[model samples]
Target: MKKRGGIRTAALALALSLSLSGCFFRGADELYAVPQPPKDYEALKVRLSEVIAAGGEYAAPLSGELIQTVQLQDLDGDGQKEAIAFFRFSSDEKPLKIYIFRQVGEEYEVLTVIEGAGTAINCVDYVQMDDEPYKEIVVSWQMSEQVHSLAAYSIGPGEVEELLRTDYNSYKLYDLDQDNQQELVVFRTPTDGPPQAELYDFHGVLGKTDTAPLSGGITAVADGGVQAGYLMDWVPALFAVSTYGGNGTITDIFTCRDGKLENITLDPDMGESRETVQFYTQVTGTDINNDGIMELPQPTPLVDYKITTATPNFWLIHWRQFDAQGEAHPVFTTYHNDRDGWYFILPETLGNNLTLARSDLPGGGERAVTFSYWEGDEAVEPKPFLTIYKLTGTNRVSRASLPGRFVLFPAEGLAGANDANTIYAAEFRDGWDCGLTEDEVRERFAIIKTDWLGNS
Candidate 1:
């Protein structure tokens, strides 16, 4: 989920003034003045085609590819929605057109047509600043191979005004702080240097407030999969940044403090591949300890690999707790493995309690497993469960259940189903907790074979 609270109320007022100047109408009566477009997709598409063709500026036919890109969204945040049509005129030299139409009575009327935007449009989304009623349309486009553009426009009654535009490799809208407002994060890569990331305040005239240096330079990976997501819900949201193809690798944790992006130091350091075969930089935001605050699960690494042997790999995992100072320290360590040929389930809080057991299945025939229990209280039922997951290509497939509490065993221990090395059996129990010793847990959930798999 995205963090909230970055836009300041004062800045929002200024942005509204600048964006709506001489264009926006005050009350609700102005909205119904226009006619609504036909509900049919074909009819709407044809109407948009005729409107563009009537422009009379080098009118070339719209391609099937371009015509199919039209979409409907409430760009203005009014109760009623609007249709946005994106199409190319004739040649690559001619700029792309974005036509916004509003529904009036029984017909659609052209609200505004944005011309000469760029050669190609990449993506479009709605962005709201603070508690503002209207949302601005954020458009990202490509002017050329080296020229990428991002612009935010305010759609008023019959006009669309440019709110903010910047030349960056990519852009993201997120509330870097937990204040319920959003900030614009833009990344730029120079042809000769390391990548740069800048944070901008969208409240006023789109001003840059903070900046940081990225790990890999732009174009380091052909389709560099740079990801920016929430890590913790601190006063200012703590976020993680992973470079291209580094989803399961290393991640850099950062936060915005006093208009600057500062890195939150991890004790043993993260993203180092020498200690383990694989590591995770992506931290999930969840309340694992049942404390109101969220905890960060440091990426657990898979250790000890023997490709030729039957011994399964184990997950070396750690949980990090954040102090009031925004620092994180490792609090717990556990070992887990996937034995049932199922996907590994990541450890997370189930219901109101933090789950002690978790698993990871990173594919390549590797599996991760975990066992967890939910004790009965005055309000709930006692439940025990096991989770398994396996990685299929880049996707992690998973299965979990309690069905009267069950356990899975490796194939060598079971008499029947010899072809299948994994055996699943149900164990009905009251519940379990930290008080239960490891040996007691194993005895309670018994197995005939002693050396079926390695210790979890």
Candidate 2:
């Protein structure tokens, strides 16, 4: 679901060093001789130190929830905690090993030492698949950049049993069929064939119950792409934001129907705006208004500039959602300024019959944007109702000195480059009835929280 890898992998060594007091192993010198850990971790640290003395190095997981080299969790529902540790040996066929140890009086005893596949650990989590008293230990292993395998093991007293294992590009654990139980939803973007979504049931014998074709253009799932939420406040849906070519990303929504996984965006009955594709920007489905249902964004050109221009200056993004009965609903509409990184939510009274014009200010570097009326082929005879200025450096200082204008500095969180030196100043046209007062306009402005620009 929420992407957890990448940066965490690079910080593993640092994290281990900082967590040394909690029995997280460090480098070679400190590994074998753990010097006076905390009282609670003294016994576990001694056991781990003995393991390190036998030429085993503490191995932190490259990705997933289990990023630490050692974790304590009650895997067998035995009330007492068990230590699960990962290690890599210099001389071993399968270098990576997962050691499970239980507390025996003052010291910890090894319950099992399971050899793991792959060069690194992708992720690890304990999940309750069925009505079993103990949860299944689920781990995803990373062999290479494109090769990954997932395994689920059932752990009992002094034993481990492998329940299910499969190779998948990405996976989501959600209740697709609404049976009050979680099912494994696996996505595959293969090199040879079309992308597919498979639904696996782990009730008794783990098997694929349903299969559906994903978007042929989808290449790989984007980081933090998989999202599980209700569609239109009713239908259960899994929104998978995927990358295709270099700069294009699309969202493919999957819902369970008749015990089969179906990509509803591809279903012909789901209305015309089903294909949620965006270029020059990657917009994922998000619950904009905290309405429970996630809305997919579709950048619609202004009515007047629909056909004439190859490049429209501004776009009115319509945050929409699809219903089960073949209908699309617009939940929110806003002017998304990706360049300066801000959003102006359009009010109901303003509607979509407005035009936004950008003009360079007097000093060359500064610019002002104006929103006016544009209905059909005629422009409304009035001065721009709302004018927005992006002020930077000296421009920000000059505007802030102008008594009332300083209050409008930094509208909604549009703090550009240097926060102290940048401001988004909004000046509403006075004495003009644009159907909304100045206070209403200020309430709707917001900063784009997502880093759509990909700048660190």
Instruction: Give lDDT tens digits, candidate 1, residues 1-456.
Output: 122222111111222234343122223343222223224333444566585556522222122112224444545444445666665665445467777776554455677776655656666666675465667676767677657678877656656677777887656677766556677777676677666667877545556778876544113321122333444443444333334344333333456766676545432343221211124322333443445554455544342211233432444446565543446665444333334422222333432332333344444443434444434242453344443333233111122122432334432323332444334433323354334432333333323222212122
lDDT agreement of model 2 with the native: 0.67
- Where in model 2 is the C-alpha error above 4 Å? 1-37, 77-81, 222-224, 244-247, 268-274, 302-310, 358-368, 376-383, 389-398, 401-424, 430-432, 451-456
My TM-score estimates for the predictions, one after another, are 0.54, 0.79
**What digit string (tens of lDDT, one per residue) describes model 2 on residues 46-93?**
778788889898776776545767765655544545677888885888
Error of 1 at 355 (Å): 21
Regions of candidate 1 where Cα sits further than 4 Å from its true position:
1-46, 49-68, 116-119, 130-132, 143-147, 191-194, 215-238, 244-249, 258-260, 266-313, 321-326, 329-456
Q: RMSD in angstroms, all models?
A: 13.9, 6.8
**lDDT, each prediction:** 0.46, 0.67
